[model samples]
Target: MRDYLIAFLTTGAITFVLSWIVWKVAIRYRLHPEIRERDVHKTPTPRLGGIAMFFGLVAFFLISTQLPGFAIVWEQPIRMWALLAAAALMVVVGVADDLWDLDWMIKLGAQFAAAWIVVGIGGIQILFLPFGSQVVVSSWLSISLSILAIVIVMNAVNFIDGLDGLVAGVCLIANAVFFAYSALLARDFDNSPETNTAVFITVVLLGVCAGFLPFNWNPAKMFMGDAGALLLGLMMASSAIVVTGNLPPQLLADNDQFGRSQLIGAYIPMILPIVVVLLPLLDFGLAVIRRTAKGRSPFSPDRQHMHHRMLDMGHTDRNAVFVFYAWTAVVSLSVLLMYIGTTAGWPGLYLPGLAYLLIGGVACVLVTLPPSRRAARVASDTKASS
Candidate 1:
């Protein structure tokens, strides 16, 4: 626990410092692109923020190796090296896209390459079909599924990067939830090297997002561009792959505390990468459908994103971002609580269900309220009086 905390702080601190430096360099060189019609920011903002985040991730990994508790991670050099190489590939693709506006085909190919490195070289791939089912898949199937998961998550995150602080905030919440789940598994079910790796990856990811949030928040000083967004998505996917693909079902089956049915349900926490990313996936699907119906390419840029719709509905920029944040938090925490209940039988399932109702109700009310009704009325009265 102490090592995790140290790793988190170390990574965050380094990222924060590097972000500041990168912002200065970008500003000096005028590295930001011209604002496009679909963009939210009126002014040009520097990008390449991913450079800082990548360094932060690498720094933390090195620091973790020095820590006595985390030193064992280095023993499995292939997984560590594979993850690092994949992340480096993502950073290169992202930087090129940010600077040169690389073709979508090139970016897609890079994503596939990164996914291959993770599955083929790192040896991380989904093996089990479901929790209770004894169905095991072929190596080819596992590899294909792992690559598919990585690509889906990468694009899902990229799509949701439409709003300031949106992707960072959502990823932060998701990684935190997964980190907690992994930590719990390590403490309770399995203390194996695999679980430890998951915990380490998640902790580092949480730090990366948290550190980058300040610079990427509303009225932003800089954008993460494709570099940071894709890198974040890759890390999140990698953590999920490590946790879900590596942790064997036999561990849960061996535990006498859960029945067969309950054990099946317990797989919810294990599959959190899919569950927690529900919003982004939904938005991505909607965007694809909306685009296809109009005879546009699925990757065609547009202003119909969920955040854009919020702006269209007259919500302030900050409010729109916060609304999405609240939605993500509610969904992630609800899933987490329900998973806990299923695993430990402590909190009731109704807790998360009720939380959903409460959060959704509040969000609806907030979104529907007129922005600064009192202020608008005051201005009108003042004009008349004058």
Candidate 2:
């Protein structure tokens, strides 16, 4: 307990100081993002905040390793090194894009290449299928799946960075859930092999974002730009893959001694990554669907994002951010409840998971309702204008 507390506080303080230092540097350099087409804010904001976040993550990992009980995660450290390398690649690509307006193709190519390096050279692949299922993929398939996951998550985080605090806030929530799940797995579930790595990465990620949020929130002082968003996305996705693929088989054996079905009783927390990250995934899905429907490039910038829709409906920047924050909280709490309820035998495990999906589905509708009405009024006004 004391170790965990120290880890959290040490990481948090390191992140804050690093972020503040980077914030000052950005101000000095005038490295700001412009209000371009499809932009959500009116004022230019510093775009290299990710630089601070990167340093913060590095600082946390270093600090954690020095503490007792955390040395192993840094020892060998292939996974950590791989993730850091991938993150650095993305951050460089992102920062370049921010400064010089790199085309989407180049940006995407950079992301894919970085992901490939991680999975191929670093050997971080998704070896498992669904939780507790023996249906594992071949090494080739695992590498392919890992690449696809990385790409999807990279874009999801990048796209969701449209509004102030959105990306940082969402990452914080998701990592928190993941950290708790990993900690529980480590403490209760026989201190599984995958526990330390999962906890370490996610804790570092949470610390980075914790340091970032104060500068990112509404009427923001600094933007994370593509560097931060892409780096964060990759880290989150990589951690999820690691947690789900490695933990279950070791901890939740398909034996009769436990008496509980590993399929049902275990793997409940497997849904944490998905549920906690529902908003970005949903928004990314909608963005693709809407853009494709309009005969436009999916990568093209547009004002059809969830936050944009909220703003179009007259929600303030802070309101739009908070509304999404509320939804994120709802999904997180629902997952926690489901975890507890399933353990207590309140209902089947899938029920709570399904309940979470249903709630997110419903919230999606409620949030868009105001925007729908606003759209009607906009059309009516345009007709009058013509």
Candidate 3:
């Protein structure tokens, strides 16, 4: 934990300094592109913040080399180095798209390529299902599914990069939850040095996101742009892959049947990662379907993203970002608590976590839609204007 804290503080310091430098350089050079009609912000903001994040990631990698308990993690250094390579590939592709708005086809190709770098070069495929006695799959199936999952998550995260601070904040919260899971896994579940690998990367992610948020907040000085968002998604997917792939067999077989419900303590490790990105995946799936139905490219840009809808439904920019934060926190924390309870063999946490999930979800839905609130505001505005 002390080592992890050092990594976090180191990453935060480096990322913060780099973000400031990048933002200033971008501003001085007027590197931002002209604003588009559908864009929310009036001024062109620098989108090169991802450059700082990439470098900060590099710093974390450097520090990781010296950290204790990493011998198990670094036994085959290729995988970790390959992860860095994949991130560099993503950052380059992302930077190009950020500057020139590269064709969606090109960006998609790079995304797949990045995933390949991780899976093929890194040799980090999802070894087996992390639950129900660790159901193993064929090698080809593992690589294919791992690559596909990486691509899906990368795009899902990128798709939600519509609001300032939205991606950074939501990811920060999501990683915070996963970081806790990994930490507990290290100290409790298996007590293997290997679990610390997940702890290491997640805290690094948490730190970078924490550092990046101040610059990314509403009325922003800069945006992480596509590169930062994609980089984030890739790391997130990779971290989950690392944890599940390396965990000891029989560690996750809490339930024989993977039932569908909120109190899914046995499946939380697998489910929580997916749930953290649930909103992004939902928005991604909906957008692809919506665009395909209209015979348009799935990556076509529009003003109808979830964040945009939140705005159209009367959420202020910060409020909308907050709503995303709220949803992420509620879902991720609920699952984390359930896992803690189940693993600790404490009083049952199923009902309590379920209650929180239901209540928080209902509140999120109300705040998200709020039809009467919108209508009343409309009426009030019309009356005031008249």
Candidate 4:
């Protein structure tokens, strides 16, 4: 834990400091693009903030390799290099797309190339699903599944990067929950949690998000654009892949220590990953469906995102972003608690997690919908504008 803290602090410091430098450089050189018709913000803002995060990620990884506690992670040099290479590739592609608005096919091709590097070069492919029993997969299926997951997550994260601080805040909360879950798994399930790579990855994610959020908040000075958002998703997916490889599905399923483990434990490993990115995935699915229904490309941009809907519900931009943060926290923390409860043989925490989900969900809906009159006015205004 102590070593992980060091890693987190160093990463946060680097990202935070570098973010300021990037903001200044971008402002001085007028690096922002023209404001789009659908954009909520009136003024152009720098979108190269992800460059700082990219550097911070690289800096932290290089420094950690030299640290004693991170020795185990570096033992397999190929995986780390692959992770870095894939991330850098995404950064390059993202920067180009952000600047030139590259065609969807070109961006997608880059995404596939990066995924292949991670799977083929880094060997971070998923070997099995952590179901009740290990559902082993063939090598071809493993590589295919891993690449698809990476690409899906990358796009999902990018799709929801509309509002100021939306991606950074949601991802920050998601990584915090994942880090807790990963840390617990490393601490209890593994002999030496100190050198565990998954925990290291999660903390680094949390740190970078934390550092970047200050500049990305409402009334933003900088945006992560495609570069930062894609980079974040790729790293997160890679971490998820590697963590699943370390998990013992059988241990998670067993009722040896506790009287019960069937309800949540058997599937929590798979569930938790999906839960963390639930909001992003929801938005991505909705956009694809909505676009395809209109006979347009799924990758086409529009103002009909979940956040845009929240605006239609009469939410201020800041309030809408907060709603996203809250939903992500409620869902992620609930599952994370369940994971701890089942793993620690504490039936008490597990049961309460269900209650937490119910209550938090209700609260989220209440916060999401405006009063009857407000909703009517918002509807009227939206119709007038359309």
Residue 171, candidate 2: how far off, in angstroms? 1.4
Candidate lDDT values, in order: 0.81, 0.76, 0.83, 0.86
Model 3, residue 143: distance off in Å is 0.3
Best-performing candidate as measured by lDDT: 4
Error of 3 at 323 (Å): 0.5
Tens digit per residue, CA lDDT, model 2, 232-287: 88888887777676554544555342234455445554567776778888888999
The residue pairs found clashing in candidate 4 are none
Candidate 4: tens digits of C-alpha lDDT, residues 36-105: 9778888899999899999998999999978998888887889899999999999999999888899999
Tell me the spans in candidate 3 whose CA falls farther than 4 Å from its real position. Answer: 130-132, 254-266, 371-386
Give me the displacement of residue 345 in model 2, in angstroms.
Answer: 4.9
Q: What is the descending lDDT order? A: 4, 3, 1, 2
Tens-place lDDT digits, model 3, residues 88-186: 988999988888999999999988899999999988788777545567868998899899999999999999998889999999999888988888777
- Where is model 2 poorest over a 10-residue stretch in terms of lDDT? 250-259
Specify the highest-TM-score model's number: 4
Better of 2 and 4 by TM-score: 4
**Could you tell me which residue pairs clash in candidate 1?**
none
